[model samples]
Structure formats: structure tokens, C-alpha cells
Target: MACDREVRRAVSGLSGADAKVYELIESMESAGIVAVPELCEAVKASTITFVGFSCTFGDDGERSIDIGRHGFFERKTRSRTENLLSKLRDLEKDVRFTVFIDDMEFRRVWGWSRSQESLTEECEFQIELAREESQIPGDWDVELWSRVESRIECIPKVCLNTELWHQINSGVACAPINYEMVLKWAAEPAQSRALDEIARMRQTYPRNRNVKLSELRASSVTGLAVYSHAGEVLEFLHPGAIFIHSADHRRDHMLGYRRTKPLPIIHPWR
Candidate 1:
């Protein structure tokens, strides 16, 4: 089973955190939510050239990503594109309302662990066909349930638990490997605002590459995140929100891969 083919390809070097960014692009592309322009915007650059799809015949986007999040990257049998497809499905399912997800922020919560399904899975797995809206959390609960393409067993704690979220985030600087720029940003008190600003900044001033995270300092217990074109990364900074990313979700940065409309795996986004 050769890789179906790469629908898209991207290269990055901003920081290792970008490994997550590349994965995001792969997910979006495989999921059919992203194109060259969209990917460039998401990853903070128009410079990204796409590599065609890497999947083979008969590999549906659903099939490519059919394996649960873990099956994408953890297992050696599935290729990376397939892993991306799997995560793409997860992303569309987990935080459907979440229009924008930072690469680093994505990893913070969903560092890729084997567990039960998500709390949201409740509505999806019910034996009864019709579920009462009152029993669900929000208005679009039913719609959310309907979109649960695949289900994985995740416990309520792992799904909704945000107990050590901040504490774990603050430790990002101390992680086995942290971004030097993020470390520098943690020192500035006024930098707290910058963290939120950082996510959006990359999209706009990607060419600047002058705003050093080390220059800004943050005192409040907030999360900061970034992405790079590197490979195989875990952990990311959260901007204004905490516990925003889904746990027991895609390790897109660290794991997750599946594909549907496989790309050509082109070298650059020509």
C-alpha cells in the first residue's frame, strides 16, 4: 500500500512548532477545507508550494482518515497522508465551530493519547435515534452529533478535564524542547496581549520575522503558541483561551493521518 499520493505539500522553517502547522495544512487539505491560498494563510505564508497527493487508488478521504486519530501517526502501517486525513476528520468533528486553530494550541490539549471517546460523543453514541435538545449542551448539538464521522472511546475526564491545563501550559517554556522565541516572550509583562496577537500576526506579517517573542514578557498565566514547517512536534501555546483544544484528539503535530481526495504529493505548491 503505497501512499495514495500527496494532494498537497508544504515546507516550513520558522520553528519546530511548525511541525503542527504542516500537519494542519495536511489535515485541512485532506478534509477538503483547504486550498493553496487557504493553506498559506493558515500556515502564515503564501510561500508554501504544494506537493501533490501521496495516496493510491480506492483510498477515499474517509478511508484515508478512517483509522482513529492514533492510527494516523502511531501505527507504522498507515502512511503520513493517511494520518493527515484521519486528523482532518477529527478536526472537523471536535471543534467544528472553531474556525481557526493554531498549530501549537492544537497540540497543547490533544498531545495524542489512547483513551475513550470525547464528552461530545455522548450524543453521537446514544442507542436511541432521537435525542432531546435539552439534554445536549448547545443549540447545534444535534448537528454536531450527526457529523461525528467516526467515534473513538474517550473518558469524560480526558474529554472535558482542564484541571492542569494552565499549569501544563506555563511549563511549555520548560518542556524538553521549547521555542526560544516563546521563552523570551514569557518575560515581558505587557506581552500577555502579544500572545493572542502572535497567532494573528504570523498570518499578516509573516515576512517581518522581526517581532521576537523574547522581547515580550507575560506575567498572567496565559498560553502562547506557534507553528513551523519542521516535523514531529508536540505541545503548543494557547492564545486567549485555555483548554480550547480537544484532548484525546488528533496528534496532528505529534500524530493523526488519513486522506480522502488524495493529493498528487507535489514538491511545491505550483
Candidate 2:
């Protein structure tokens, strides 16, 4: 079989070690062991991609059977390669290959002639379960599993009076209204005293409670009321603490009133 057009183009510019590597892959392509169109195109474009290839050398440094990795290619491709490698090893030839993605290499098969009894056994089992026609195992309930493992509840809304809301909106307290801003403020060493004050206030009024913003401003322990208010604002805006609306109308009224209904539960997997 002729090597694919893309495969030839992919190795057209290479020399030395890189050229040797692709030559081994081309042999596998010609043998109908694996199709390399996607892999070849990625190489030709110099884009990052994953592929596995191996070369075996004799004691006299003669190169022998070269093959691609299992799992990356289709079942038939893997099966053919495995069978070919097995037959080659039966003749006492060394067979080995390394799996790689771009510059990173992994799971190198060294001394394959002496490693194991069967090459395709474990691969076949895994491929069968991964096939589109295969049914999920009976022991697993996907729906219940999702509900238990993948759900995130909405945070309760906080209520603030008009004056306190204006104070925050006017930027007098430099309140953080988003998760990233909260993280930035929290990381500052200068904000430590304000964070301590906020922590003390949390002990008295849990985060989920509908507390007035005025309470945070008045409860300053370090006498820096502005910093205390800003720190409290960051706590409210922390991830998993509250959902901040992007719309102007909703954002305008965010601290004005408490929401009567709970926000919808999030299913991250979906």
C-alpha cells in the first residue's frame, strides 16, 4: 500500500532523528496497521498533536519492527499492529515503541519480546467497553451519580438598604463585586486586618443570612470602616458565595432586595 499523501508531506521537511521517527510511522501506514491522516496533517501544519511510535534495535544497531501505540488508533489498527509486532517477536526481533504528544513521551514499551504473553488482550477489553454500541455497566446509575457528584446549589441573596447600596455603588468602600476582584483583594497583605474583621462578623452572621450592608460598615474592628466594608463585599462576591448578574437592571438592584425564589441548581456535567 502507498503511504498517504499527507503522511509523505508531513515528513518532507524532516531529517535525522525526526525523519527516522516518521519513516517508522510511514511503514505502519503502508502495512495498513494504522491510518495517519489526522496525525500527518497536524505534523505538516506544525500544530501540537498526540501520536505513539516505537523503534527496536538489534545488538548490532540494526533497526527492526516499528509500531504505533494502542488506545490512540482504532481497534482494527491496534489489533493489526499488535499481531504484526507479535509475529516479528516470534522471529526473536526486539520490538519497542514510545507514546508521545508533541515533545512529551510516555509509557515506552522496552524489551517487548520478553515483556508479556499477549499484546492485544488488555487493549481489546478496554476498547470493547469504550465502543459506541457497548452498554454502560449495570452497577452504575448515571442520573443518581450526576445528582450526587455534579450538582452545585445557588447561593442565597443578600439584602441591603438604599444608603448602604449607594455607598458600595459609589466606590467609596472600593467593594469587590466579582469573584476575581475578591481573590485579588484577599491576596493583599494590607487587607489582612479587614479580612480578620470580616471573619469575626461571619461568626455572628453566617453568609447565607439576609444581612444589611450597613452592618458590615458599622462592625469594623480595625477602625478602618471602608476597608472592612470592602472586605465584606469581597466575601459576598467570592466563588460559590453568590451569583452576580451581568444585566444592568439586575446588577443595579442586586444589593437592594432579597430574591424570593431560589436560583436554579447547576449541573456542570451537562
Candidate 3:
């Protein structure tokens, strides 16, 4: 109830289309109201595990938006950490494996920094710490956090070896990373030319359609470099890391879409 009140207060301050949407969201919470088309599509669409990443680097080689800027962050971190917590809870229960992709603007919009932990890392630690300190009985908090964290298997756009990267790039017309899908996810559609450009690229380098999830291996990431909207990199000192890259480098390097199989092994850290 307290959280609801706070959310109401926040929504009340929104104006224009934002306000209307939030109003509907509030209705959804209070009366189970929802936009019919979207609800219907969501209900009808085949469920798949999808993970998204924007570029971490700007055109100027600086840091871009960080985990704090994500919609799931509610324009602030820690204060709205519950939003992410809840998302992970859902992801664990529903998703099996996720497909990761990066955008070209990743480098153009935000530069990379060697510092700062990725949002995923932040989420992992925060949940783990919260569980350890929780007063809840049966250590349910820990179970919840563990349940969500263990299932995650992250893959990078760039392969660990340049040979694999070349192998993928040589056969595909376009770089295989699905930038179009990422843009659509953000409610931003690319121009037709841009779409065609990728299509042509894909045509020139037609990809092998038979790759299997089990054939892929997860990359060993040392640290996740987080980009900040303020145009800087945020650094975190942690052992486990998740790395992401952009597809804009497709013309110069190999970037391919690869499926993932849920590993029988859990995250060793958890």
C-alpha cells in the first residue's frame, strides 16, 4: 500500500502522453484495465526468452546510459531497486534462455568506460546482499535471489576468438546481430534504408541457418563496463561480470545472432 501511494505520487506528476499511460497503468493495478490490442498481442505472441542491450559507448568513446537509466530503474537506482528485483523474479520463473544483441549507436551514443559494473552485476549483488540481511523467515529472500540468478547464461555479440568471429562474418551478408529487433523493443523503428542496409549486408554475407544453442559456449567475462547517461563509465569492483557489445561494427567485424541452450549448470557464483 505504501509503495502504491508512492507510485501514485510519482505518476501524478507526469504530463501529456506519459501521464495518460501511467493513469492506465494505475487503472490496470486498481481495476485490471489494459490496452486491448497490446494485451491481446501479448497473450497471443509466442513466448521466447529475450535479453536486450543498448550500446555502452558513445560516438565520442565516452560512457553512455547506465543501469540506473533503464526503464526498469524508475529513473533512479536503489530507491526503485524493487522494480528490478521483481523483474528478475519473473524472468526466473518464465524465461529459459535469453538472446542478446547490441545496436550500432551503442558506440555512437555512448562511449565505453572500463569502470562501473553492468546493471546485471548490480542486480546480482543487491539481491544477494538484501537476502543475507533480510529478517524474513526460512531465508526466503535468499532462495528467491538464488532462484533468479542461477539460470542466467549471458553471451556476447563478439565471440571469444577472432576465428569464430571471422567464420560467422565471412558467410553472412550483413552482421547477424538483430539491431532491428532491439529498436523495435524500444518503440523506435529504424528507417527503411537502414533496414535495407542490414538486409543487404546479410545478403552479401548470408549466415548459416543451422547453428544450435548447445554448440555455443558462454564467454568468460572479467568485468562489465557500464555506461552512464551522463556520458561517462561507471565502475564496480566485483568478480563476476557480464559483457555486451554493439552491432555497428558489423561492416568491420563479424557479428552474428546465436541461440542459447539453458545450461544444466547453475551460475557458479550463486
Candidate 4:
């Protein structure tokens, strides 16, 4: 498919680790969460732009990142973007870029794996019915969910386990060839603060209520998480669609790709 080829082309220069991160982000997007503007902006300003994504590395390395930090590079000229992307690609060959996913994100993906239908089912249920006051760990706001539910009410459920496995078995090149685990650690309970900020924004801002509401809900629903395989806490960041790796080395990064909508086929052949 031209689109699939284009998707591959967009991530051409990334290392296996970095590519997997992009794939995970795509999965989140497929599920209807907006792209992490910071990461997307960074990629756009760099040489490579993911026309779209569908797609890890594990090793010892030093990293400087935050658990929920967000930053973006200003748009650059084509030449500069290419140059920066080239440098990052070149550096990757020798330095080994790694994808450090958080346990929550790991669980999401893992839940898509065989033997976790129950977990995915539970997750889906929570996404659909859990309220702000619910004990569910990452429930979004009721008002936001109400709007989102209407938008995504009709999308079919995604069998992530089957689809992902099929892609892996078919030798899809959208993600890393190997699933490496650097460290298994816990994710911080920082979602509450994020939710609080969303509440404030919803109450204080009158413009673009639906858009803001959806985006705010999306932040809690399907943002990409950036983690460090070297086990370092990423710097602090504002409440947005971006996140840091983890709080300690025991866990490199935990990124949960959630959504109110159905997951899309990251790389379609047709």
C-alpha cells in the first residue's frame, strides 16, 4: 500500500528502538488520541516526518529525560531538518538508541498480546464507563468522556493482540524486530495532577470547548510516553500529550496508549 510505504519512509532513519517508539505512538493515534505535539513538532522540525506510524531498543546507557516532560523544536528549513535528522540517525548507529516504555504502556501492549484478553476487556470497559470518581487508575473526566464517547461510539473494537501478532509474524517492518526489556519498574501516580490541570482548563476557558475537552480527554486517554532505557527520571513538563520515561531506574519508561475510539490499522496493505 502506498500509505504503508509512506509510513515506512517517514520513519526511515530511526533506530529500531526509536522506530518502535514511533510505532507505539501510531497505535495511540489509531486509537484516536492526538499525536504528542511536542514529539510531532520535534520530528517535523527534524529531517524525518512520520507521514504516519504503526511501530524498541534495550541496553545500558545514560539518559536525561523527565517522567512527564514536554518540549518541541521550532520548525526548521528543509535543509536544517534533514541535517539534524541525519545527525541523529548517524549517532544512533554507534550509540544505540533505546525505547524505554513505562509499565502502564507496557501493560497496554502486553494486554494486546495473547493471554491477556481479560485485561484488555477490563481496560476497554473502564475507558467506556469509568467515571472521574471511580477507583480506576487513569479514568478521564466525565464531561470529556461524554463528548468523546459520542465521537468514538461507533468504531469497532480492535483486537490488538491478534493484529499485532499477525503483523509480527508477517514480518511487518513498522516496529522493532525484538522486544527487549531493560528493567521492569512501576509508573508514578502523576495522572491526578494532569487531570486537575484539565479540570481547570475546562472551567476557565470558554473558547473551543469541545475541541479543548476532546484534547484534554485525549491527553489522559492516548498520549505518547517517552522513557529512558538508562533508568533516569525525565524532567518535569506541563500538562500536555507528552510524558517522561519514569521515576527511577527500576523502570525505564511506562507509556500507556489509550483511547476512547477504536484502534486503527497502523499499516494497511490495501
Candidate 5:
């Protein structure tokens, strides 16, 4: 069977009919929580999987799989390690079937396969990381941001590629956001131009449409939230890697930077 080899290899360590349970426990651990003991005791199983798989790099220079691990470690000092690897771990879990896009800004690029079927319960990226009144005027409405979680079909899960780099604010960084519908709605009657820009780019880079919210290096890059706040949303187009270029490169970038064809105005994703 196509899955028998995988199932055999997966359960080789645990042995017996407990592989299904082991799979479930491992799934839980991949979300920053380790409840294996509870699962083990409840299921009357003695064997427990220590952890999920890890990324094994090779000289092939042509393939990669960022395993998504979110469980706490065994060491007492693992807390520090947790924070350090938080972002990286997030990427491992958020985006499934990940294929690299670029070496220069790998976080900025990735190919994603849709897992919309995984959504048993609705999970929105949630908007607004900060409290209200803390937000500046002309910026996003924080309270309004929270509502999108329940209302929208999808939400971006922003994060940096590395936690250590994120804490110190190192690197170009990115916020792997999932908010599109509400964000487009947030643009209001005036910001139709930005929405149009997003659509045009999306058409060229159709793959970017289903970005795994955790795969993109969110870092401190503004607007990583699900709603259309100034910082949580994509300011311009998504950064280069996975991003497709406009047919008219001369018209790309700020007004004066490109002295060619005028960029077209765009409305929100309808």
C-alpha cells in the first residue's frame, strides 16, 4: 500500500496498534504543547514518541521539507531554546509541502499546497496584536481587527523565520499573514489602488494566494495580523521571493523610480 511503508516506518519505534494514537499525540505536540503523557495515560499506552521529525539537509541542493514541530522540549532549560526556535518551528508547521523559492530571501518565497481540508474548526489568524488606544490614528482599528477572526474564511499566521533573529530585530524579516478578505474590506472606498495591485500580482504568482501563514518570515515586518491594520497587512506587494513581477517592470516601485507606463489602480479582491 502507498501508505503502508510510511505507516510501518512511523510505528516501527512504538510497535503495535498504538501508531494511530501516537500520530494524534504527535499532532498535538506540533502546536507548542506537549501532552503526550496525558495521551499515553489515557490511552493506556506505555510507549511515547519523543518528538516529531527534524529537517535533514543534504548536498542535493534541490529539495527540502521544513518539519513543523511545536512541542516543548525535555530539558528544564528548554524554555530558552523554545523562544529561540519558536519562529522556525512555526514555519515548519504552518506551511505543508514546502518547496524553497530563493536562497537570497528564502523566507520571502515558498510554494504551498492547499490544506483547506484540514480545517475542522474555523481558525482565523486574528487581527491586531496590540491593545486599543495604543494604536495610532490613521492606523488600523484594533477592535475592528478582532472581529475578523470569527467572520473570515481564512487568516494569516505571521512569524519570523528565526526567533533569535526576531528578538534582536536582525534580517529583512517577514510576517506570514493570512488575512485577505477582511484586509481587502479594510482598504475602504479609497484604497482601491492597493487592492488592485494585490490582484495583479496574485494572478502572476497564483501560488502565493495560498501561502501558509506560518511559512513566511513575518518578523517585525508590519501588518502581520489577519485584519487590515497598517502593520499587520502587506504594505505593498508581498516581498520578492514568491512574489511575481509585473509584466511592466518599468512601471514597478514608487512613482519616480520607474519612469515608464503608469501603474494601474486596483479594487479589492471581489
Candidate 6:
């Protein structure tokens, strides 16, 4: 009964083809003329219904069954109907759901939905680009150093007496400079204390990192320089970006950077 209530709530919000499929499932459950337990259960699991129905009974092409039409019930036998229900149930547990849906029998069904093909193609293109970029000499290290040099040239030079800077200059190797550590060595005590507070605030609210970093840059008079063993630190820098000088003992060590698209915002209700 709880599952039925959930199914009813889900059905109330759905529209277009998804709503129609659930409507048919609701009709079958209430009719009591046939025992379609699998269909009834599928309706109760909203995610299962949302993903399975469009994947299994897509509305495209000549062979596609029009569940929207009243004649569909008359055309399909009880056994055939049960077989389709069983297939939908089995699909929920299948590890290769994508492969199964791409099969000829189900491929047409996804016509109304977003094309998984485009996503696959975009992923493949990025992989290819990475592979090609890796073959270039010095990889992204040269580019990172060039950017760092350019930024440093534009900013005023202030002597850094921090232990981290000493470790880097002495070639003893040191951890990459982070926001919290970077502010402790600020030239002016007042600016240093303010930056430290911003860093603390960043810990409580992560989205504020960029804003805090911007404030640090606007108020600071010196370039922030630090050493890293790898170039991956660029990914973490926010507001004004920084290039970290990195070196490794291995002769064949290659460093690279891959720019990724920003993640989509997810809504809690969805």
C-alpha cells in the first residue's frame, strides 16, 4: 500500500510518454482481469519505471508498439504482455543495461529521450585529445612555467621567509602551497591576519574559496610562489590561477592538464 501511494505520487508528476506508460500500468493493476505482478512492482519503484519504460517500449518506427493507443491492449496476448513485463523487470537487474537498450529491439524506444550517443562521442573525443597531448614534449609543464613567469613578471617581488619557500629553494622538496599556509607569510601583518580569517571561513563554506582568494589577490602586493612535485595543483587554484614549479627525478616523467566541463547543478527533488 505504501508502494502504491508512492507510485500514485510519481504518476501525478510525470508528463508526455512516461506518464502514458505509467497510466497503462495503473490501468492493468486496477483492472484485476489479469495477474501482472511484475508490471505492478515496476510501477512502485519510480526510478525503475522512469529508466526502464522509455528504454524498453520507446515510441519510434513502424515496429514500435504504441502503448498510447487503445488498440494496443487488444493486439497483445496476455502471454506476450507478461513477457514484456518480465523483460522490463530483468532489465532493472542487468549489469549491461546500456548495451541491452542499444539492441535492435529496444533502440527505437529511446528516440524520445536524450541521445546517449552524443555523450559517448564527447567522452571519446576528450580521451583522444588527452592521448595526443601526452605525446608532446615537456607536455603541460612548459605551458605552466610560461604562465607562472608571465604572472610573476607583472606582480611586485617580495622576499618570502616562510619555511616552505626555504624548502623549495633548497631543493629539499615541499608540499604544495595551500590557501591556509600561503596567507601565514603575507608581508603585512594586518593583511596576513585578514587572509588567515578568510582561509578559516573557506573551511566552513567551500564555495567561498574563489571569493576569498580574489580578496587575497586584490589586497596582496606580492606574487605567491611555491614548489610542487607535480603540476596537478593548478586544478585546485581558484579566482586568480597560479602555476606551481614542479620537478621530478624520473627522466620520463610527463605532466599534463585536462580541462573538464563544469559539473551540472543537481536539484534535490530530481
C-alpha lDDT values of all predictions = 0.27, 0.31, 0.27, 0.29, 0.26, 0.30
lDDT of 5 by residue, 33-137 (tens): 222233333223232112111111212332332211111112321333233224323333221111111111112122223233221111111112111222111
Clashing pairs in 6: 58-109
50 Cα displacement, candidate 6 (Å): 40
Clashing pairs in 2: 54-97
Compare candidates 3 and 5 on lDDT and give the better one.
3
Taking all chains together, each candidate's TM-score versus the true structure is 0.18, 0.18, 0.23, 0.19, 0.18, 0.16
Assess the local accuracy of residue 63 in candidate 2 as a C-alpha lDDT between 0 and 100.
26
- How far residue 46's Cα lies from its native spot in candidate 5, in Å, is 40
Q: How well is each residue in 99-123 modelled by candidate 4, as lDDT tens digits?
A: 2223234243322332334433443
Candidate 3 structure quality by residue, lDDT tens digits, 61-87: 343333222322222322323332234
Model 3 Cα shift for residue 19 (angstroms):
22
Candidate 4 lDDT at 25 equals 49
Among the numbered candidates, top TM-score falls to: 3
TM-score of 1: 0.18
Score residue 204 of candidate 4 by CA lDDT. 50
Residue-level lDDT tens digits of model 2 in 1-270: 355665566557565544543444445443132223433332233222222211212232322221222222334544454454454345443444222111001112132342222323332343344343332222211121112111211221223233434543442433323333333434466555554545445446566256655454333322232223222432333211211111111112222222222221111110
Candidates 4 and 5, the one with greater TM-score: 4
Task: Give me the candidate number with maximum lDDT.
Answer: 2
How many steric clashes between backbone atoms does each model show? 67, 1, 25, 20, 17, 1
lDDT at residue 61 of model 2 (Cα atoms): 30
